[model samples]
Target: MAVELQKKGNFYMGEAPGMMEMGISNKNLDDDGRAKRTGTLITASAHIITAVIGSGVLSLAWAIAQLGWVAGPSVLIAFSGITYFTSTLLADCYRSPDPVTGKRNYTYMDVVRAHLGGIKIQLCGLAQYVNLVGITIGYTITASISMAAVKRSNCFHTHGHHTKCNVADYPFIIIFASIQIVLSQIPNFHKLSWLSILAAVMSFAYSSIGLGLSVAKVAEGSGDVRTSLTGVLVGVDVTGTEKVWKTFQAIGDIAFAYAYSTVLIEIQDTLKSSPPENKVMKKASFIGVSTTTLFYVLCGCVGYAAFGNNAPGNFLTGFGFYEPFWLIDFANVCIAIHLIGAYQVFCQPVYGFVEKWCNHRWPENGFISTEYAINIPAYGAYNINFFRVVWRTVYVIVTAVVAMIFPFFNDFLGLLGAASFWPLTVYFPIEMYIAQAKIPRFSFTWTWLKILSWACLVVSIVAAAGSVQGLATDVKAYKPFKTQGHE
Candidate 1:
């Protein structure tokens, strides 16, 4: 890769340090790595929780409810299975490079850069941006859904006002987004992890209430446990709609689970902090992926059960269900807060990129102060608001018209993400190991990664297909008054 280092340390896309080498390894890494800044495990766990529990999670019940009680459980098993394989393969890829560099370490960019070269290296960034930004958009929309749901029940009054929908909720979405954007630029954010914990706890409360209500409702009408057993014995599959993309949605869901590549670089950097041992890296992956899988399954089950019937939008209508508006109001507050944490982690790179650019591009004359500032300005950006207006306007035009011809948002989009990520996260790293092996054959692993890589490729394709299919078949929209589980 060609890097034109200007008088200042500024470099552009063409010559960014992201290019070259099998990975980005700074040999002079400190004894402590990137994670040295990390605090307690609760904080760490909180970070992971918020990052993974993105907007797609709102679809858990909405999607699972379509397949019935049985299908709800199926999603859990499927995601767990896919995540195990994907994570194991990814960990194995990292393990291959024995005596790996510390701190400044290899990244996803290097996997492609090593094998496919510069053009492909550039594409990796493109993939990262697409997956992450699309994810951001999806989060914003989900936040809107959550916000609108909360607002809805507050005004659910008067027989004549029943038809008056909450179209005015759009402004709230912009406001919620404004909150996220402002939080993104903050530094010294270890305390913000609590926001994720708050959301998770709120989600837990929501699931508990919904589950209790569904069970009580089922028991009251079914005439005892025997009837419940019988109901379980005769589960139905509503995913049998004529839509071809339903299968794709399932695939995409599976793919989305594997989108763990989003933080692969971070993981590697974390491992680099510890001793050069594969065990720690492998342990972290196993713990993270396994825990995440189980957590998803349990949460998905509770949500699906709460709905009992397949409906659309979110699994549970936060606002319209059960009693006081207090529950939903709290849920909205938690979602908004949790997303605040999520945006901060993801936006770091964007801010870092720009800062590095400005630092390097501008000459080290009397006009600059670069005392190793990490975080950019977090709040009070009048110019940014103006920029957002123009930006959103353009985004609407492009996304609605030109982007329509391309695959923008759908069930298959997740699958597309999974498919691209399969290579970036699972296969490529292991394949790189095989390519660079010192001894052509090493015990059983050399042969294993080879087989595993192909298997990973297969699963990615299948999961992506399933994600697309699931998305197409799973067409439940968020309505305030619908009962009978999500379908």
Candidate 2:
């Protein structure tokens, strides 16, 4: 009797398994069987910038205020390095073999579920949804504030600051959310490349304008310049518990400022794997980080020098929307445009998660398949469906409502950073890398990395606590829902 059996390791009867294998998926191809490769190095870099830089940059001066000159820039640089390292780890984990086929995990949850397990997947999904939704709310708040600032500036020339300025965030939130609702229909992250570039340019525009204004203020001796080795310590500082709490809060803020890791895998999925996948991603990461770091350092130090401890959470607010008013208006416009795009970029993953669940639960419902591609001019072909409209609209509405209710712009930033930044940015990447790299638990490198991970956990805990304290304090001190009609 002749018995034939397939070898355990052999994926094929006699052919050796190659290093990489192709599999069909929505991400891998368009409708016409053409391989989908959308983002280039430039566009990838643009996505990175649009993802990394947001309302968080506006909070850097306030972050510097928390840590003072000595620790402020130091923490920003350190987090940048840390985030870059973790992001590379995520990039590495993007591709993995599934017994006979290789697959690219498109979302953060996919990575966790693949390496970790279902429990971690659920937790990651929770953290990511909260992080993304909370972040959108924060952006909404910031956009409204920017609009309000411009309006106030425009109005102040006619009606003074003292003249009962009741122009609230409600109107601006509705208008901006309307724009976002329309833009959210783009369907794919890679398709938003031009928008990402536009957002990046806008980010630079506002940042440059802010930096130039700040430098002019300092040069002319028109603004306060407080520079010292220990500027924060020198003053009558918040001693005891409050000081320690604020320090933790500052770490959280810095973490939030550097966090694009949560969406790194999704963004990497947008790039073509032709130029070696990790290489393209790393280059894009380096470009985006370097540019944003430069902006953060300049804006933080200059804004700090100009306003010292008095620097508002948004440095633009510190500028008070005064002369060169056109620049301020333009900067705010840039911010508004950038946030609209940023909202879509970040929310794409969230939508995917929801849609995936819905499709699995109600596979027979025929909610319009997203499997095939429709060709578009600039963004190539994309899979658009009716579900995109319904789900994303609901998502936008929810975020808009939260923004209207909380409207605690800066406070919410600290809260989100503290709560989500560690798990998504620090903890997940380090753990996943150790698992993927097969690093021994007690090995010298593993021991050190584990220690660093633990340290991050501690920081995250303290930061969360401190952020909660700060939020509560703000709530008691200041009223939420600034709009009277909303209340």
Every model's TM-score: 0.67, 0.86
lDDT of 1 by residue, 268-366 (tens): 443334444344555555555566565556555555454444333354443324444565556555665555556555544443343444546653532
Please give the range of 10 consecutive residues that has the lowest summed lDDT in model 2: 10-19
Cα lDDT computed for each candidate against the true fold: 0.47, 0.73
Candidate 2 structure quality by residue, lDDT tens digits, 142-198: 888878777765665567645544567788999988888888877566568889889
TM-score of 2: 0.86
What RMSD value applies to candidate 1? 8.0
